[model samples]
Target: MRIYELGDGTPEVSVVGAIHGDEPCGERAIERFVDEEPTVERPVKLIVANEEALDAGRRFIDEDLNRAFPGDPDADTHEGRLAHALSREIRGTTVLSLHSTQSYAEPFALVDEVDAVTRSICPHLPIEYLVETGRFSEGRLIEHAHTVEVECGLQGSEEAAANAYWILRAFLSATGVLPAPVAGDTEPPLSLRRRDADEVVVFRLLDQIPKGPAEEYRVFVDNFQRVAPGDRVAAADGEAFSADTEFYPVLLSANGYDDVFGYAADRVGTLA
Candidate 1:
């Protein structure tokens, strides 16, 4: 149970990092901010979720921490108990939950539909991949606090770290934690959805990945971009598989019982 809190004016914001221990890249990034001790006009709390797992250097010791939010106090697992405590900590605060994707894509922000909070939020996140995150399971911290989960992009890359850096800066400025806004509201050329529906489909659970290091075969050329049937989307066992001859197949995102990362198949021109 490690909690990092800085800034001492009024408690208006809280940022959560790494519900999944293996996804600790965000934890490292946020800790950098906390250690720097940025002066603030308000109070901000940085919570290191699943500290036990963090210490062990794993994603989660018991269960998927993200799914366990708004937890039951009587949870039997350590992760679930932490989720319960965290839910109580983040009530009514603007939250920036950090994440990393296996996708080679640079970085993106997953937000809900356009609305007051989202409008104010979009401008702050420099990464441009904004997609609807649905209402999501009730009582998750982000849902509880109008929070947006930021995907820092491919784990273990300097580029990904840089993405987190710039976005976090924009966030700090927008919240008036830092000096000023780096840029005014910039509407991304594409809407929250991908530019092409046939390009890619986003999914969780990676049962379809080839297996072992064979998982390396799965590659994404674009960030949830679309493709057509017979197009090379992602690789299974590092081998490109042609898309199925259906519109739905063009938007193929496959997950089975093997991987946590679901996939996309290249559907070439089917949507066209």
Candidate 2:
């Protein structure tokens, strides 16, 4: 992990990037922002995690770092040891961990569940959706207190990098590390386009959309769109499966994961 800090005193605000080496958007955003040398109202720690994997140009050297949180210092895997150190770096801080996804080309936020910190920060983000990982939060960084994770956009895309930078700026502004955004602010017009009525639709992950072994796979529905009962969800080797009940697809993508296409989520409510 590589860490950089702006301002003085121990930082209570932190930003982490590049946990998955395959996702360069986060790292790109951090470097771009740091290049500006913007003045900050409070200290903020910015980190580039999984540097080894990044250097290797692989998703991980041993295992997924996001799934190895609060890891053991004595653990065997490279990620396990790195997780332990990374966890310590952001502990007790209001954190934004950046990421990009293949499932969606739009930014969205995720947390273990809605809480005071979430309610306070998420609404200010340039996103239309907020996901509650709930029971699926096992070993994820968001399980740590005061952490918000964002899926910036399609992995490896320049748009994702651009989105990540603005999202970081918005998050820092919301947390008071930077001046609040205002009319005629330096931020581009896209950053000001908050969701409908300034509300973020909330979704709770219910179950994984299982995928069986097949030569090829395909997904039919769009992420965040509701799937009606009996709607065709996906196909494996031309074998199709239909939904038994209504659900909103979250992170649904063909070939995104080996064992699953994505996740089935329910629209719980909206956070204003």
Candidate 3:
């Protein structure tokens, strides 16, 4: 784990790089932020956990880093051990983990209900979407750390990089690390919700694509889209079907590698 020093105040924010190897945009974005180091005085720590997995340029060598957070110290994998240590180190750390997705969703903050502090600080950035954990999924980094995960954009996509640039500056400014927002950036009033009933849904990556060729026409869709029953979503070999009922899904991902194991949801009406 590497810490980049820029600001001068007490450490309050610990922004994380890619916990997953395949989603290296956050790692790359952090590097860019370091190169043009902002003058933040606050104790803002930035780290890239699971270096080996990240180096592999794959999601993980054995286990997913995001799911490994707050793990047992005696865990078998390096990622697990790292998560255990990292969790302890950042126990009281105000954290933000940048992430990306396949859909062109706007940059959003997906955090747990416990992260009211992070929710309080949301307005410092220009993200329109603020997702809650149950609203997205379990076993995610933000859920594990009880921190905030900002969806910058599609993983490795240009949007992810571009958003990371300005969002980093906004983070520095909002955290009082930087005296002001970075150039060409104005902090948008963050849409902080304790939880959006309408935003409730679990997300997953579809992994088991059908085993035959020419049946690969279906692609991932954005979160919260309506799925009609029997609607052929995508097919690996068999005819993939959708729910017959009318329920809104918070579709966090539209597509990824052929990992057809995505999430299904049961939303509890959100609080206004």
Candidate 4:
């Protein structure tokens, strides 16, 4: 991991990037932040994780790092060891873990639960949605107290990099690492100025649409849109698959993952 420290006290905030090697947007954002060299009000740590995998240009060296949280230092897999180290790196800090998704082109926040930290900072993010991963939080970094994970945008896209950079800036300001933008400050990309800092559309993950053993598959629903019973969601080979119940698709994609189509979620009302 590459660590960048700004300011002189004990760091209370941390932003982690490149948990998955294929998602380089976050790392780019971190580099951009380093270039700007903003003088922070409080100490902050910016980390670029999974360097080996990143060098290899693959998702992981042995396993998905995001799913190996609180990992074992003596474990066999590279990700397992890395996870343990990362967990230690951000412990007790308000962490913002950056990620880029293949499913959606829009940014969104993800949390293990909605708590005081989430309620305060999530609203400041450049996003319109927040997803709570209950049962799915098992080994995720967000399961740790005060950690927020963001899906910046479509993986490897220029827009994703821009979103990640601005989102991290907003997070720093919200957590007091950097002074909040004042009235005379120049407008940033995707300005949060016009947004209600108290509002966010929330969703709770219900289940994932597994790819099963299909050789060829295609998703037909727009992400964040509702799908009801009998609604065709995908096609595998020559057979069409329809939903059995009503739910909204969060990360809906045709070939986003090797084992899943994306997530099915339920709207849980807005946070204001």
- lDDT values for all models: 0.58, 0.93, 0.61, 0.89
| Per-candidate alpha-carbon RMSD to the true structure | 6.9, 1.2, 5.5, 1.7
- The reply for model 1, stretches above 4 Å from the true place, is 135-141, 181-221, 229-272
lDDT of 4 by residue, 1-272 (tens): 99999999889899999999999988999999999978889999999999998889899999999899999999999999999999998987999999998888888999998999999998888788899998999878898899999999889889899889888999999999988889988655653332555689899999988887777888888888889999999987858889999999988787887888889999998777
Q: Is candidate 1 or candidate 2 better by lDDT?
A: 2
Model 3 per-residue lDDT tens digits across residues 1-272: 66664556546677787777777767887888788755556668788776777787778877877777567789998777877877865667777787777654457666665345654566566664454555344556676544767777777777677676667666767666667645676543342222332332332332222223443435434455655666545444454555555433443332454444343433333311
Which digits, one per residue and each the tens of the lDDT, describe model 2 over residues 1-272? 99999999999999999999999988999999999999999999999999998888889999999899989999999999999999999988999999999999889999998999999999999899999999999988898899999999999998899999999999999999999988977764464356484799999999999999999999999999999999999999999999999999999998889999999999999888
List runs of model 3 lying over 4 Å from the truth: 8-10, 135-138, 144-146, 180-221, 226-238, 251-261, 264-272
Off by over 4 Å in 2: 189-192, 195-197
- Which is the winner by TM-score between candidate 1 and candidate 2? 2
lDDT of 3 at 56: 78
Candidate 1's error at 164, in angstroms?
A: 2.4
Tens-place lDDT digits, model 1, residues 181-218: 43575423332334453332232211232323353545
**Cα deviation of 4 in candidate 1 (Å)?**
2.8
Provide the global lDDT of candidate 4 against the true structure. Answer: 0.89
- Clashes found in each candidate (C-alpha, N, C closer than 3 A): 22, 0, 33, 0
Q: Point to the candidate with the largest TM-score.
A: 2
